[model samples]
Target chain A: MTATVPGVRRGAGPLPRALHPGAWWLWALCLAVVASRTTNPLLLACLIAVAGLVVARRRGDAPWALSFRMYLLFGAVIVVVRVLFRIVFGGGGGETVLVNLPEIPLPEAAAGIRLLGPVAAEEVLGGAYDGLRLAAMVICVGAANALANPKRLLKTLPGALHEIGTSVVVALSVAPQLVESVGRVRRARRLRGGVGRGRRAVRGILIPVLEDALSRSLALAAAMSSRGYGRTGAVAGGRRALVGTLVIGGLLGVCAGLYGLLDGSAPPALGLPLLLGGLAVAVAGLAAGGRRVRRTGYRPDRWRGAELLTVGSGLAAALVMHLATEIDPADIYPSLTPLSWPEVSALPLAAILLGLLPGYLTPPPPTSEVPA
Target chain B: MARRSVGSAALGALLALLAALLAPLSPASAAPGLARPAAGSAGFCPDASGVTVVVDFRELGGGRVVRCAHGPQADGLAALRNAGFTVAGTNRWGDAFICRINGRPGVDSEPCVDTPPSTAYWSYWHAGDGENWTYSQRGATYRTPPEGSFDGWSFSLNQEEGSAPAPGLAARRPSDGGGSDGPGGAGGDQGGAGGDSGGPGAGADPGGAAGGGSSPGGPGDAGELPPDAESDVEDEEREEEAEEEPDEEPDEDVDDDRSAEAAPLPTEDAEWSGTDEEFEEQSAARDDSGGPSAGTVATLGLLVALLGAGGLTAWRRRRAAAASTAGAGADERPADER
Candidate 1:
């Protein structure tokens, strides 16, 4: 139990305070970017492992922290669904046939489409690889959700995005809130000598939990509004219009720039120049709009060395993976047609290993007994 | 209660209908069928007994290849394979949408994970002996090429349907009198029911007609009687042509090699050997399947170790918290309770 003092370094370890929510988000999103760059299951599994390790080490004893298991289950479901789709549709034209399912002949209109036929090992593995990539992305986001406090994340948002951030934070917290409500409701039911099982038990628990959650959220909304959470100082209509135009136009430019960068065939003018220009314009607009709002922070989270190290480690992982893409694309995207085993290169593996740094380098999350 | 029973019955009927629709119409047939053992030639097929496959690597920068495929059951995809050509399809569409042939646009160029953009893709075409190329409307998996026909794959980039370049080689067989302009003469007798040979303007007609006609029979039925009969007749004619021109095979092989060496782009005479030992070696290397490599295994071990470390950290934290709670009894309740 240490006080939330600024720059209180004690010997080797930093003081046990929660890392900035923005730092956790940046780290997790960078991990997601690493996952997106490759379909190799080995690399994806490594990413999932990295995310799980970080979550286990850094997550506070919050209700939302427990939802990581649900995300893991969702990821499993995604892999299963992808494999099932491969089975239901034709499992491609790979040479290695694993199962000979009965082939269903479709009508002439559906000529190219094959219903269940022979399942190929290659096709199933390919589906699994693709599914793992998506799962890694989802789990990375989930890790961020578990490790970072949603309210704190909203607080970090710029003034221009405060109203939107408030809504988003509320939406994000709903699942954890509902979970807490359910537990409370079930505990109450147990005290009243009711069996918390079967269909009747579900109905009894569900109604009260929902009601409790709704009332709690309503109270929160009331509290937030009373405190003038989304209030903005009066500004001239023309100034508002100028800010709106700048933001919207910048956002459009960013979208165009991203499209151009991802697509090799797109014109050169729309790529890096547009992206930088759009970012500059957007930042300027946000700054101008923020000047209009009158707000003060109450012990706002500080970005210390630990936060810097955490974000830097994640960025390094992403950068290494990007460089790996240039070195050997074949290793990143293994051929599935011939059913070769997916292999990860040394460089990308080392990059993923770097993702483990934040788990050890950042101070352990403060024990929950410490009062805020 | 009565309404609920009625709804259940309706649901049951719907489920039954779906099951029936999905039920296999016949016993499982061998999917690849009985493709003849590949006897790919260095040039255009010596006779009309087989389908000749030509791959034009236009913008992808490879010389044109002509190889012959023999079999009654040879569809467009089968013909390509039977001609000793390896093809890769888009992951989304399987063998239906041809993405790469002999791995031209490699993983770095096009990953083949999805349907390639219309800007760059292998455009499918079909032609008769000494006939103009027609763009195929149907996918390769569904369309069965008739005996004596030519299956062409040209890598088209940002080209419209009409403008997409076809395989550089003239679809003429060497036995068709070595004349450059013999399509008119050959079209009269050899152009079968499927071969609607005209100029590029008339290409769409044959393709559209074949697509519509073949739908009812499907790929399986389309590969049956006509091709068998045509192959038998052509087999006899091929023997006669072989008797007449005994020394043309080696001469054509030499011609093919020379043309291949001269042209960087695909040209009429530039026919690279699809069945070359070099190509076989490359394909063999590509198809070397095995278990995970040493690096992958090491990485997996590292992942496992990380997970273990995570578990240890979590367990330690839990134990330390328990010790603290036991030591400081009613002074602090658990955070979960709050």
Candidate 2:
């Protein structure tokens, strides 16, 4: 409709030109849903790929994207180190001997060296594949974060948790403000004198920062009270109590389901039902809470063919990867020792790449320098 | 578009890097000392035909020494006193003790008896000994010196003719119990001299074909007694039973076969060499794979990550919006500020 915001381009394209930030939750929720159902490598891979593409397409240039890419790198390092440490120290009889160092415990095979010392060819390849899958997951999450703006996202929050959402939203913003305030304090100090070395910088920074933070908090509290915040003047009798109980009970049920999953002995048939029931209760609580709040005009994220493709392609790719990849991180030994290279099916990769389409179309807000 | 492509390429590179790093850490096995039996403590003593006590020496710490863990043969005279077998001779040997039952001949000197074999019994006080003892089947021998006195023991039980069931006869269903036992009575009658001569053959008879020894009864037939072929047969039967259990799958055979084919079968009592260390390796591998319950954990982890990201991203956007509209809310603050 109205392109009030700069860079808000309009087109008759199938996908929503600008996805409401709230939709990011749907993407995350979808990942969680997929994860809960299957640990099948193919499914997890497909899920990760699709989410990654969505993230890249939406907000690849955002700070989150950069950190995510780095995170992937970090994950890879961890994999290599883990494998190396294991191969050198861990035990497994192997035939192909490498070095016969006295300290290393000879035959290389007997010293717990496989493929080679601290470096089995098979284990390395498997670890790398696992690392890729992990990276894909991180990127997907990063993309979601980058693509969605905060205010719009809060709107999608279940009404039952408005206060929680608001609190969380405020707390998160505090970090950047703290960073900005530090800059201001530094500037103020620089104008007077550089605080000439030796720990004075720490004192100069801390004192002003604390004073500003406290003053701001007081001002915020006073302002909120004058505006009648949290005073909706509704009768807080039976219904309120009932709603509160439902919310707490639903939360507890969700925790119980999680505990059952952790326990592992829980029957799938029973666990799934409990989990679903808990989710249903939670959704109901949200719906009830929304009904209590003031009425507002309807606004919904536009669903288009491209957006569907974005989500579908990602989901499909993950499913396909899971099915195709025989790489069970758990069964890494057999999977690695056998050393059969899983055929990297091109079609699924292509599908996952396609899923990144939406993220490309949706750009993030321009990064701006804040005034202290 | 070029920027976007670059970004995607960067993402791919990062994934590759992560894959590389994680490769080395896939799952390290534990040290050899810790890993347990590869097929898990099975082949050690499959089933109880004759009880096999594997001391698992590591389970038993050091200090107290058992002069002879096996039976009296290895220890001889000294072992009799150590085993509390009623010392019959002067307890002279510093390392050895000779003994005989009060009414019977000492096992060290007396010949192993024939029919109605003499039973050698011994009892020791709990005064000094803890519950550590090793007793081996008589025919089994120790290649190395015994760790301590009564550290382990081995012996045999010879029965009177027609009394004990023959080898493999014990395992058969009771329905198949009726059989000829010994040739003594039959041979006596066949002499055509005394038809009433009562012998072992007269008591129980399994025709010569069924109960025949591997070779016709030779001299000292009671001495060796073929070292009990029933033990091996019993082992096979137990394996069959374990496999047939509803809970156990046939896959166990595949593993056993693989083990048999892959490595040399470790001898029963040779230096306690086996794959207990492999258990720790398997466990560690399991840990890397994120364990059996990994899928659920991964899902939950993703959910938490998403929640954090969503909340943070929203807050950032809100702060921006609030900054842009700061002056709009400034004027309304007067009524509240007062």
Candidate 3:
């Protein structure tokens, strides 16, 4: 009889490795940029097409990835419901009245209610078009994720960010380890008959999770020191550095004050300044941070031409979306009123989908280096 | 292949529908009639100078035409007669007259109203005749540069039956044949410089009587015309010609060819004189017309799109689950004992 060893595996099946995590990040950025701009149907539809092309190229004819029957059925039902809802409750400047619902009165109430509809054709269709674009974008993103592996995500980080990257990777591992520790503690508690109720289980879980996390953090600190981290003198200080710090701090304070004065989501004048200030502070901090260890020897992998293509495609999609869509935040949801549904529908969903495409073609990390 | 085909087909139909639906409504694709201004602009905003002129036109239509100083021209019954316009109708003491073909909507310039309307509406004078009066009780004082001399001017009412007069050109005919030629009057008819009243002979004969008294000074003196006098008719003929031809430029760009006229204040001896909102309710009515609460369209679209995405996700999940189940079932077998 053949024996099976059960544990977490290093790599997924060879069906087709998912795109790199960088691609997903790019997709997210593109979505944000595209959403800021257009709701035009034509542009969105084109984006959807590009997303499809990406899917096709990444995964070799994965039939289920771009499933249409389910999507269409869902879309049709939603459209019908939306149209009916709008008809019943007047909206979108729809004036054509096809029928009215019988009035229903609350007993002894001053007001009674009746429903109204067939909303104008323009509003219904316009709403549906927008819905379609959003759906397309979402599907493309999902397909990209499903096809790409998460294990290789760290490969994309810049070498300068190795410590932060390592921290993040270790931090990610903590949750799973905590879960395992909790299970062990629960089992031990059960064996000792010390926990019986749901409350006991929560106590059991929390204690072990926290203890494990703390212990792991201590061990991490020790391991980092032993490995000669910060050997490159990243934190050497001088008066010039102090002056730089003071200047940056003062500028940041001023920016913070201005931000408080002009605080609002839609005001780019305010947001842009804050963003620039924050970026400057971050760059300064990075510049001033303690050194990288010479012996640690961590380096970001060179991006291949194929990888560049994937990233470039995502960037292109994002740029195009920014150019094509209406960037006015007001258009998305007008203030002091119910949200602007019609305008929201006009978002370039298809363009977002295209932007999601590059993530699909990104290469996954080599299976050999994956921690088991 | 079938799935791909279905996806592509649905995408195509969706795209085509979107394209067709979007053709006419975008600001970029505004209706041709209302298409003069490009996107994001109401057009232009004129300053106080423009506002003053519009106010002047309103005063003129409101029959507030008082006699006042105008530039350069001599004043007399003959001169007054030379500046006549045909009144279209009489109502509420104000008579509407057709403006010349090239006549501006009013003195207001384009700068007075061109933004897309943080607050809606651009203020400009529209020259429709008849009882559509824009009333202003602004009286005789007008602001002028500290160093400039004021010219006397006269205001009149005319009713041109079929056609409008040329802008700034009025026809005046002296009742007593004081002999002022039309637009470019000859030298002999100069009754007086400035807006002085005509001589005794010119005043005694009703035929030569000036329509209004001597011109008054200041800005509020923009509109003052006597109801009972006819002036000379020289420029009036040229106005008729100008009216016969259609204006080359758009209405917004139309400019006045004649100098602005302000009527003189009446002389004490001169006889014959005459002499006018529920905000909440209005707002409610306008609000009702404003159409559709926010994000209704977007929510509807989102719901539909999400439903589509969710359905697809579920289907894929189910299919994968089923395939895994099938494979597991097929692979399962009694442990082999060797």
Candidate 4:
């Protein structure tokens, strides 16, 4: 296949040389953080669309990539389910009533709980806003799943995490592989006699699927071992214990720091310092662990200018949303009273639009298969 | 005369209970004066030149006081802030867990209502025409007061046991609920305040609702201005006030015609808090006048544009896939033919 775009070197080895997989995860994470920062639907929608565009533009012809549509469908379901829950459980008192369900009075003990009460516009809007934020987050995770090859991403992990990353990568790849396996078996069975129903067919299909998964897992284990997977240098017991302690302590500090930043009730001291100290300790542990791992990679992925730009776009979106929330919190959490249009600020919205840059700026993913 | 004295004596006892209950909060509120400055006036509303907010501090012993403040669209929380009363609350229920109104905390006490327990929390009520109070169905953040109203707040100690009672306050004007309540023309004078005698609520509303709250000359001018025939015209203004939230959200006609900035400001009605209300009114004005400010428009525009780009990307990918497949089929056909 001929390269159509200028400045994209065909000598960059076969068209569509894979992007640094870490770039995709970083980008998706940034988009997710932006979604979490605001309840504004318009901003969230833009973030979702940008993710969708990037996924569509760059995603390889892989089953994991195809799963993006599933995320979108799931997002729609979440919104509908959230609204339904609000309709079923929401009590009266919101000014704008969309639908009033018959109220069922309960015993005094059930005072706060309302069943089948008026479904107000406010409740629906609130639910939809909340659902949309959650859906945006889910979609970001899905975009990362769809765009980045999990095995490729695992390859870029620190040497200390190499063994763990491989198992995780294999575990993730199994779902998509299982889906493909099931499809293949079904098609083969259809060729024989349009898959018969009842106990016989269930037995036939279940046996094959389980057998296929076992064989696949064995093959994966064999392949991993053949690649000199267990290679490690000797380390003193005391030093190993120290590394473990630092790693565990750092993880706890990070957890505490994260909770402090996200929760208004947590103490002030647990926030920045704890996060920094935890990160410092975790890095030290990672460095120590790396020394014990005697391993090399095949053509390790380079972090180039394009990779930085891709990651930066996502971080930029998150930073912009942070500034917006700081400047005007009211727009982020609009009032539901006297129901009117919730105001959206230009700066934050502009920032979200900035996420669209990678969709256009990065070289388009080369089609994997040669057409002619 | 003996029965009236007994009633007054009961009222006096209730006040002492209220004052004692309020003792915890009075330090923070530094409440202007508990001593009834006059027989029927004091506490927030000096007299009834504006809307009277009745604080039924039931947990702090139930008695009510009248305070003048902005209506709900202007944020009733601002009313507490305006009166120099500090309110402690959690945003958990969006400012609904108002544990302390002034310094008296309803939570973390000896009986300890941990955070937001339903048994002992602040409940809200409102009285329109200053007659009978109605429970505010929604939380304070979402429920702005309707036209010509009195705001009531009560701290229910044990609402789980039974219904919380409205604070039996003497400040409430005795209700002879007739005449003035008629459509559109409620803006006209009632000729007499009746049992309320110097009733601030009745005295204040027409001037306030008709857009006169901004001007101090509001009440006296509304009192004398064509009390009989031109009453319905005042009702038309009051009717606009009836749909005031809608009135506030949109620009020009209601505001310009209402502002009447020119020609000596003819007894401006609508009990607007002027400064705070004007700031909110300006925001609303920007929204209504320009259809939407640049921020909203850009947000919407960017959203649509990004979605469109996503669709375009999908389309381009599809076309590329088709072209490649077609190219492959053409090449394969020749090889198979050979």
User: lDDT of each model, Cα atoms only?
Assistant: 0.64, 0.37, 0.35, 0.54
Model 1, total clashes: 1
Question: Which order, best to worst by TM-score?
Answer: 1, 4, 2, 3
TM-score of the second chain in candidate 1: 0.58
TM-score, model 1 to reference: 0.76
Q: What is the DockQ of each candidate?
A: 0.19, 0.02, 0.05, 0.11
Instruction: Name the lDDT value of residue A9 in candidate 3.
Output: 29
True contacts kept of each: 0.38, 0.00, 0.06, 0.23
- The alpha-carbon lDDT assigned to residue A360 of candidate 3 equals 41
- Residue-level lDDT of model 2, residues B102-198, one tens digit each, is 2123222231111112332221110001111111122121112122111222112233322221221111101111112333333333212212211
lDDT of 1 by residue, B1-338 (tens): 13222322332342243223223311111122112124455556655457788776645655556677765434788888778676666655566567777776788867777778777788777765444455666677777777666787877776653345555444555453343233453344333322233232222222111111112222222232211123222323333222222222233343344334343222233234444444555665643323446776687678667666655555555556555555667544434543
Best by lDDT: 1
Candidate 4, residues B253-296: lDDT per residue as tens digits? 32234223332211112211112222224334432231335666
Q: Name the candidate that leads on TM-score.
A: 1
Mark the 10 consecutive residues where model 3 chain B has the least summed lDDT.
Answer: B86-95
Q: Write the per-residue lDDT of candidate 4 for residues A1-372, one digit (tens) a residue.
A: 542332345666334556788998888877887787666666666677778777776777665666777777677667668766766766223434556679888887765467777766555665666677788888899989888877788787777776677778877888878877776777678779865899988787778999999998999889978977755546788987888788778878888876565432345798768878897888888788778876677998888766788899988887887787667665665443323354786777767777777665675665654653
Candidate with the larger TM-score of 2 and 3:
2
Candidate 2: list runs displaced more than 4 Å. Answer: A1-17, A28-56, A60-67, A77-81, A84-119, A122-132, A232-238, A251-267, A270-272, A295-309, A314-334, A346-351, A360-372, B1-338
- Tell how far residue A102 is off in model 1, in angstroms: 0.8
How far residue A232's Cα lies from its native spot in candidate 1, in Å, is 4.7
What is the C-alpha interface RMSD of model 3?
17.9
